[model samples]
Every structure is written in structure tokens, then in C-alpha cells.
Target: MTQTHPTFAEKLIAWQKQHGRHNLAWQVSDPYQIWLSEIMLQQTQVVTVSEYFPRFIEKFPTVQDLANAEQDEVLALWQGLGYYSRARNLHFAAQQICHDFGGVFPENRESLQQLKGVGRSTAAAIAAFAFGKRETILDGNVKRILCRIFALDGEGKAFENQLWDFAEILLPENSSEMSAYTQGLMDLGATVCQRKPNCAICPMADICQAKQQDRIAELPRKKSVKVQEMTLYWLILRDKNRIFLQKRPQKGIWAGLYCVPCFENGADFHNYLRDKQMDFDDLHECATISHRLTHRVLEIIPYECDCKNAAFSANFNENDGIWVDLTDLPQYGLPKPLQQYLA
Candidate 1:
């Protein structure tokens, strides 16, 4: 006998009300705080984001403050959070809020989507939390849980759009209820319907298709990804008291961050330093450090510079150089694995 499938939205929200995350520090009124949290949480786990969110919000309390801030400052706050380009987009979005939107995040979805870094999920979160709009959320967690429950089979974009259509349909009429439900779905996915989910006591166990088919883990089909390896030459300049840092172009990896110079290849790297007329005693700190992204393996060759008290440019307009105080290195952000390596 085929079972009558019931929507688990109410059950999830009720469970959320009874046993959901209530005291997250990032759940604040200021759109700036909310926006910061949304960005930090992307492609990142809640447990991981928990440590970074509050500190970031305190540093950049308002969108105006963020807009006025320098790229290095923003990127430093975003240390450990991969996808550094998102921080750049959020920074530019903040600036747009200040100039284009008059320092207030848009109350509607259309304009919010126009802002940098505010994609569907982030925009939905902001609209629901900040503006009390009834926008649906379709993050990874949500997709996993929903796919398992509905037995959605297609992979990649097909599966994603299916879930989105379902999400929009289930958005509650009241924004307050929608907000609670949205958070509830996220909470359920993160805690109960996990990667290796605990479906036995799940609210939807009564009607879950994955449970019926005994394939909970296999429901959220994803497209196969091809990982590419990119080679990088990282030139580290140190004058004992300081290390030279540079701002990456406002696009691509490590955008809006401070770090030693990086080159696409050895020849390009040598030419960069030569063009700047900088050559002194140097130390090869390590052969290479590997930083892996979702679809890329970045092999970095780290070369450390020692000036031997030889005076160089105190402050030059070199895109490849900024002398950062050693004691104040924390002010400039390093990548997560890199930070651990540094320590």
C-alpha cells in the first residue's frame, strides 16, 4: 500500500521551537551582523562558523563601517573562511549599500540579489531575518534533507531546481513563522538529517521516501566535479621585524586579502620582483605549501626574504609589497592551513 506523504514543515518548526539553536550571537537585528553571518556560513559548517561570526560582527559593526574599511582588514577578519572572494563581494556590497542603497539593505529580493555575494540562499536569509520577508531557503543542508524526504532523483542543477521549486511552494504565509521554519530546516539538516543522517527518530520518518527505500544517504545526488591543480610562486619578504604583504586583485582567489606576493609561474614571479627593483638576501622557508579549494589544488612555493638591515622601500606603491609588522601579523589574515603552518 502506498503511504500518504505529509509535509514535515510543521513538525520541523515545532521541533525547532522546542529544541532549536536559540542563542547564536549572530542572530542580531543589524543587517550588517546578519549579512556577515550569511556570508561566513556559505560552504562552511555552522560549528566552524560559530567561532568566527561574533568576532567579525564586532569588528565591522555596520555596513558603513565595512564599506569604509580596507580590503586587507576585511580579508583578515575572514581568515580561515575559504572562498576569500566572497568577502570581497560582501565588502563591495556593503559599499553599495552605503552609496547605492543609502546604507540600508534592501527590503525586497530583487535589489538584494543585485548586491554582491547576496545569492539566493544568502538573500533569502537576509530577507527573512532582516526584513521579515517570506523568502525560502535552499542551502546544502536543506537540499539534503528535502531530497531524502521527497526521493528527488536527478543530479546537479536538475535536483537543485526541483528543491528550489519545492522550497518556494512551502514558504509559510507569515514571515515570522517562515523565519522560524527556515531556521528550523537548517537546524534539522545540520543536527538530525546529517551527512550520515539520524533518520530513525526523524520527524519525517513516518513518510520519508529514503527511509522506505532504505537509501537516505544516496538521495541527495550531486554532479561529479573535476578538481584542477594550479601552481603558485609565493614570495615572502621579511625584514626580521616585518613581512612584506600585498593585496590581491579584486577578483579570484584570496581577493581582498593581505599576503606575500604570488605569481602564476616562476618566470612571471622573477620578472615581478625584478620590475620592482627588489633583490636581497633571501631564505627558502619551505619547498611548497598546498591549499586545496573545492575544485582546485593550489600548490604554493614559499620563498622568504631577509634584508640583512639593508634599507629598501619603506612604503612603495607596489601591488606586490606591503611591510607588515611581525608582532602585528594577526591584523593581516593568513589562510587557515597557512596560519597553522605559521604557528
Candidate 2:
């Protein structure tokens, strides 16, 4: 009888057992921790999430605790995470788990998808990692790995179904090994099969179709992004020890977040100040900063206008915003770009 060679899952599992990340802060079997890590890891790197995860868990130790916490507190904790909506959705999902599932995360993929921010891939990850469920996860990293290994064709969402099929085929048979197999794909992609993949050290190097064909960089193609540029005028109004910030409408960019009062251009800003009869002791242009989002780039120009009196004029209403203590600015859930500017 002829001896059979190891399958892709077996090779990946072997590689993971030897080289995968096993000691991360959220490498536990707890569903809550797994869910948190999955959400945090979305559009974020492990190194960045590692810093915020421990602090967030310390505050909300349990799903019940997270459900009971305020949105401001949640956003404050997730201040620098970039995607503020993730924090909001996580809070909403925690409430849902508490009220709908009795504070226990659903062990099945179907029920997990009902939660806010929990997509098909994330639900699969939580189910597999926390409950040892035999579900396939096709996140960005795993997608890259599978695409390169099989040399998948098409671009963007066009190849999603094919990728999912590959994911299912690569899933380990034993449910007990689900966690290892799932994490293996993640680790292999993140550490070895990255954009500039170190194909030499990759466990799948021997079999990767992209590597074999020298098309690793071109296998997992993406949709072209056209970044739109917009200019913004920020009035950095300060009085004594407080800085005036406006609460953005709860719908657009930086929704429900605090920011400096913004205008489209310098003319609009000056007009608004003139109409409000607002005067400053010293007003001058500060350094300009450029912030790039997924599809939009903002050219932010700030005008530092110092006010002698800490009190706002009678024309300023409650809807405008509040004057926060300069010392306590970091505690607010400001946008990452704004936070960096302030810092």
C-alpha cells in the first residue's frame, strides 16, 4: 500500500502547533473574550488590539458588565481604535446577548450572526474558537492565504463564494481541532503569507499555487480605491484651561463624537465667527494635517483662537457643544486623527 501525504489542514495545523501565536491575551476559550478579540481585530492589527484589549477587559470583565456600561464609556475605551462604529456595535451586541441570550454567547453560527457587528466570518471564528464548532472563517487574512494557496481568480467580492468553498474544504474534520485549524489559517496568512510574503518560511510554500507560479502578490486582488479629498477648517477655540468642541451629528463621519467646530473653508469659518459675534485674543493658522479614511482624505486646517474668558457668549447654545477641560481631553471619545492632533 502507498503512504498518503499530509493534507493542507494537517500541514497548517502542524505549522501552527510549532509557530502560531498561542500566547496572545485573548487566546482563551471564553466566548466573550473571543468575540471581543474578533471585533477588535477587524480592520486592526494584533499589536494595536493587544494594547486596548486588556484595558477594555479590565473595565468590562463580563458581557453583563459591558451591557450595563454607557456608550460614552465604551467609545472612550475604543477612542484610538479608528472604527468607532465597532465599539458602538459591540456595546449593542453585548446588550443583545444579555437580553436575548442571557449573557451567554450563542455557540452556533446562525445565532451569533444575529448580534450587531458579528458578520458571517466573525461568527464562525467565535463559534469555532470558543465552542470548538466546525465552522469556517474567511476573514481578510484567511482569504489571502486561501487565494494564494489555490491561485483563486477574480477580484474583490467576486471570488467570495469560491473562497468560502475553499475555506470549507480546508476545515479540519475533528471538531476538537477546529480552533487550531482556524487559528492556523489566520497565523499563516498574517505572519507568512502577508502582502510581501516570506514564501521561503511559509508552511504552505511547497504547495502554494501562487508561490509556485510566482503570483503571490497578484492572487488575492482587491477593488481599486479612489480617495476623494476634502478640506476642513477646525476652530481650535480655547479659553483658559478648556477647549470648545462640538458634538458631531449621530449619522455622518465621526458620529456622536466630539470635535472642534468645523467649516468647509476659511471663509465659511470666518463668516460663522462673525455672525456669532465671537472674538478671539489670538487667532492664527496652525500646522495642517491630512487624514485618510477608507475612501476619503481630509485636509484638516486648524486655527488656534485663544479666548481670555472661559465663558462662552450668550449666542452659543447647548446644541453647539461643551467646553471640556484641557486636561481631560484625552478621556473623551475623540476621533483618532483629532486625538493625534490634540496630543
Q: Please provide, for model 1 over 262-294, each residue's C-alpha lDDT reduced to its tens digit, 9 standing for 90 to 100.
A: 788878987777776766344565767887889
- Best of the candidates, TM-score: 2
Model 1 TM-score (2 dp)? 0.88
Q: What TM-score, over all chains together, does every model reach?
A: 0.88, 0.93
Segments in model 1 whose C-alpha atoms lie over 4 Å from true places: 1-6, 156-159, 272-285, 309-320
lDDT (C-alpha) at residue 35 in model 1: 81
Q: Write the per-residue lDDT of candidate 2 for residues 1-343, one digit (tens) a residue.
A: 0122249889988899999999999999899999999999999999999999999899999999999998878888898888888988999999999999987788899999999999999999999999999899988788788778877778645468767766786678889999889899889878888888898799877888778898876877876878899999888877778788888777778887889898877788878888867654357888889998888999998888776653544345576788899899867799888888877
**For model 2, how many clashes?**
0
Task: Name the weakest run of 10 consecutive residues (lDDT summed) in model 2.
Answer: 308-317
**Candidate 2 local lDDT, residue 209:** 79
Candidates' C-alpha lDDT: 0.77, 0.85
> How good is model 2 by TM-score?
0.93
